[model samples]
Target: MEEVEVVVAHRDCATLRVGAVFLKIDSDQSRTEVEVRAMALAPIPTPEIRWREPPVLALAALPGRALGRLGHPETASSAAWVAAGATIRKLHDAPLPPFPERSRADLAAEVDGECAWLLANDVLPAEVVTRNRELADPALRPWTPVFIHGDLQVSHIFVADDEVTGVIDWTEAARGDAHYDIATLTLGHQTRLDDVLTGYGPGLDPDVIRAWWSLRCLRGIRWLIEHGFDPSLPGGEIDILKSRM
Candidate 1:
């Protein structure tokens, strides 16, 4: 048996890699259900599903390396980022999945709850949390929902030789605002926005994208902390929020 590499191990879920097969073990079966359904519906390249039983979903790993890490500069060429943008465009244009019950109102409530937790626990400075919370409010306004790769961080996108090979981690895939995907992809790497946007094509609302950026940071910090990550790192979630100020 190959040594199992722990991809992620948190309170609610865990994922492990055993050679070419990824075994995801989650406490929430609904998330796994959504992942399976989303993968079945997505138009883009995703990992092959080897099998699934209850809380464990087995998948074949993709061929290429991730596009980049969350806190580091992407060494991939601009063409790769552009390709990622195009891939996202294709995903956005695909038929909507049956998931996404999270409305803007729901998101606002989540933000409020998380912000209150941060303040109550002194997880972040009051001003920083308050200001970003205010900035994130506008993103709660209504927008056309589309099939989105709920978490499109660079690390989730795979590429080889400047071509997109596959995308992974579909647990968050749902019908949501399209700009949310764009913001998720470009969160910490603002410098690559132009490259991604170029391939994503025109007719996007920049302000909404920016607002999602703030919202993502605000919503992510607590989760990262809970997952044993320090969001205060130079390129961490806090940095993403501060950059917008």
Candidate 2:
């Protein structure tokens, strides 16, 4: 048996320090194959992403490699999209605890702190933040939470032979509206949405999906404004948000 090699240690989402490894395994053909491993090294005593308590799991390892860079766009067959959607549906269907008693205003206030930092740093234009606050819909937000893969872009989705082999990065996974997960994917990678929706099955409401999409856009914009020219932010995303605005 071979051991996994730790390759890198870095911080993710400004909260968790991630230690990534490369595991060597023997293939059916008696060849060596390398698999990636990721685990959370430490918890941010003061997490900026949200005001949740400590995470349940201390570490998690994904089964496959991240696809290229984060948020890179890729064209997929409708069949592929359906597969991704089905994957999401399975994740959403899983059991999760209910959301905490925080009001929508409370959530907004938490996010406002991050926005304030971005504004102080000049990472985001004041106009953009004001517009986002004005457009926020408290009622549209989910009161009861479902399982959400906090970050669900193409990079977090792993593929093998044109199929989604696994979903990675459960560190940010939490109880939220199902649409939060769906919206994250659609707004971050709209090109593959048709397939995602197709795989999500027939019971989903288009209106709900649209609403989530808009919310996802807002979320992405906030991140970009905070991070300022991050490699993770896609060019198409800026274009999409600009068009909408």
Candidate 3:
């Protein structure tokens, strides 16, 4: 029998891997449902659903390895990164989902709260927090919405033989700014941005992408703290924030 490997475990959800199958357990079935719907909607390769039962959903493992993890050197070839970007472009070009993600006003408020929390808790120096807050401002401006994989982090993308094989973790998928996806994928890996943009085509604003990097890092710090993650690690969120300094 294959051993059960714990993939992820937190108060909100947990994921376990058993040989070729992955089991996802969520506190709220709505997220699981959304993941199901989003994977169905996605144009790129995605995991096949083995089965589902309420809070638990089983998915057959994808064939390729993850593109890479944050805080680590990326091993995938430049073409692989470009393939990931092209895959994202196809998804963005698809028709919009019926529901909307968080509005800009709500996101702005959240960022304000996170900034205040980070400062109050001494998580970072006030100057750093203040500067990042300023940098995050431009992302709050309006954008044309598109179908987006909300958490397009490196580890969620898979590649093999210089081709994007599949993408996973669709819990955060929603209709959002295309640049947000671009920014999220390139965060902490700035050099790869150009490679991604190659297959993603042109017309995206570099300033907006940079601003989203700041916003995402700012908003993520508090969550990382509460969730027992160390964003201060090398190449982690703190490093990403400090890179802009």
Candidate 4:
């Protein structure tokens, strides 16, 4: 008998895998709707949807391994990271998501709210949060919007033999800053950023990318804690923020 593996089980959603099939259960059907719609529109490789019944979505698993994950050392080759970048460029150059344009104000407020919570809760030293807040400011400025993955965390991207195999978890897909995806891809692996940029083409600002790193880690610390994830793990978000000092 094949054992069922629980990939992730948060209050908002849960993913289970049995054999080559993944079962996604979400409390909010709208997210599933977005995932389905985004996959259909994305130009890159995505898992095939086997079935969709309210609250449960079945998908065929892709063949490759995730590029890397947060709080862990990256093991993928430079070529693979570059390939991942090329794959993202393809998606960004594709047509928009057809959904209402996302609000930049809302994104700023969310970051501000998280920073406030970090201070109020004494989550970290004041200097660390304050400094990163200043560093994260550039990300607030407007720019040309593209269809973004919203959460292109390294683990969501898979690669094999120096090529991108697939990208998963499209619930947060929306029209937003393209660099957000680039920043997310290089979250803990900033050293490999040059390789990603090599395949992503030009016109990206490093200052903006650095700012987003602060914004994402600062904003994400709250959710990671609330959802029972440790952001303080050696190379995790906490360290990422402190290093900004």
Error of 1 at 40 (Å): 0.8
Clashing pairs in 1: none
C-alpha lDDT score of every prediction, in listed order: 0.88, 0.50, 0.92, 0.92
Collision count of model 1:
0
Q: How high is the lDDT of residue 226 in model 1?
A: 81
Which run of 10 residues does model 4 get worst, by summed lDDT? Answer: 98-107
CA shift of 10, model 3, Å: 1.0
Candidate 4, superposed: residue stretches over 4 Å from native: none
List TM-scores for all candidates, in order. Answer: 0.95, 0.60, 0.98, 0.98
Candidate 2: stretches off by over 4 Å: 1-9, 12-71, 97-103, 115-121, 138-140, 203-240
The per-residue C-alpha lDDT of model 3 at residue 89 equals 95
lDDT of 3: 0.92
State how far residue 112 of model 1 sits from its true place (Å): 1.7
Alpha carbon lDDT at 161, candidate 1:
92
| Superposition-based RMSD of candidate 2 using all C-alpha atoms, in angstroms | 10.5
Ranking by lDDT: 4, 3, 1, 2
How well does candidate 2 score on lDDT at residue 78?
62
TM-score of 3: 0.98
lDDT (Cα, 0-100) at 127 in candidate 1: 88
Which ten residues in a row are the worst by lDDT in model 2?
30-39
